[model samples]
Target: MAKLLLCSLAWFTFPSFADNKPLNSPVDYLSVLLSLVVVIAMVFMLGYLMRRFNVTQHGGGQMKVVGSMALGTRERILVIQVGEEQHMLGVTAQNINHLARLETPLEVPQASGDNFKNKLSQLMQGHKGKTDE
Candidate 1:
């Protein structure tokens, strides 16, 4: 077991020793930093060019998220408007379910300050209070 441990230790330490060649010339920290900066700049440039050319996006028709409500810690209910039709979906970490298709679609909630939370709570409450007709 000691022999195995020694062998493993030697194997790990071997690379450090191999790479420890005496510096033939002074290490230019500035040049190394400049090269790193150039590489990062090149990556950003390429990303910008790709985005400018729209290379990373697949063309799917836009679907609007009308509204959403959090049911629990990893679960949500979403109302999505695709084209003219509206869909209510139950979303969880596990999977999504089709909840209902509204006959009379609910109005899109107006975005407000802290009142948005109040509106959301009220909306959820209203959903619970009202029965399906």
Candidate 2:
């Protein structure tokens, strides 16, 4: 980050070949539009790369939180599974700490496809049964 800042400062300090004239030609406008497109594409490509590398960890996959228990209003104990190993973590408002590493992995149940849909249908059916009574 410092390097980038320094490089940018250096860039502004250096002389440029650009005339700094106002855009007057269709070719100049086209060039500006193309540059804008390229910058936008680069931004999207960077986002794709970040998601592909799991940098943001948006979805549950190999690493997932198995369970969590709240200790206080601001603190909790969490069990997270990474690959086959399960780890206990202590989380607070300030920071997170690793509590322990489990020798035996905890079994987590897998949800069926359309889990929310199934749950909602079951609730609707239960409501109908009560009203029919």
Candidate 3:
């Protein structure tokens, strides 16, 4: 047991021998900083790409979120449109429960369906037409 304990203790104390080497090297620090920056930049880049694509998506898919309401911090009600039918669902932290299937599907707002790109293109077209005149 003492041999095992000494062996474990010796393993833990190997870093103490590293006192011969400097604790902080500028090159090491800079490389770590650059690596962190690159990882963060990649994350932001991927997020931007996903957001850009998602924003340009048109509405009126076969399955769509018709509406949603927050009941609490971790609970909410969601109305999803599948084909021609709408389903009401209760969402909680644990699980999702289907409340009912609505006979009439609720209307999805015009704004939710229209993304910024479509609106911007329409605005540019109007501007171009005005300039042509």
Residue 94 lDDT (model 1): 94
TM-score of each: 0.37, 0.42, 0.57
Using lDDT, rank the candidates from best to worst: 2, 3, 1
- Where's the lowest-lDDT run of ten residues in candidate 3? 9-18
Q: After superposition, how far is residue 120 of candidate 3 from its true place, in Å?
A: 2.3
Q: Highest TM-score: give the candidate number.
A: 3
Better of 2 and 3 by lDDT: 2
Better of 1 and 2 by TM-score: 2
CA shift of 5, model 1, Å: 48
The local distance difference test score of model 3 is: 0.75
Model 2: worst 10 consecutive residues (lDDT sum): 9-18
lDDT of 3 by residue, 62-114 (tens): 87888899999999999988887889999999999999999877886655335
Model 1 residue 16 lDDT score: 38
Candidate 2: misplaced stretches above 4 Å? 1-58, 112-133
The sequence of per-residue lDDT tens digits that candidate 2 reaches over residues 12-129 is: 4322315556677777677666655765787799899988765765435788888889999999999998988999999999999998999988887454335777988999999999
Q: After superposition, how far is residue 102 of candidate 3 from its true place, in Å?
A: 2.1
Compared with the true structure, all predictions reach lDDT values of 0.71, 0.76, 0.75
Flag regions of model 3 displaced more than 4 Å: 1-28, 44-62, 109-114
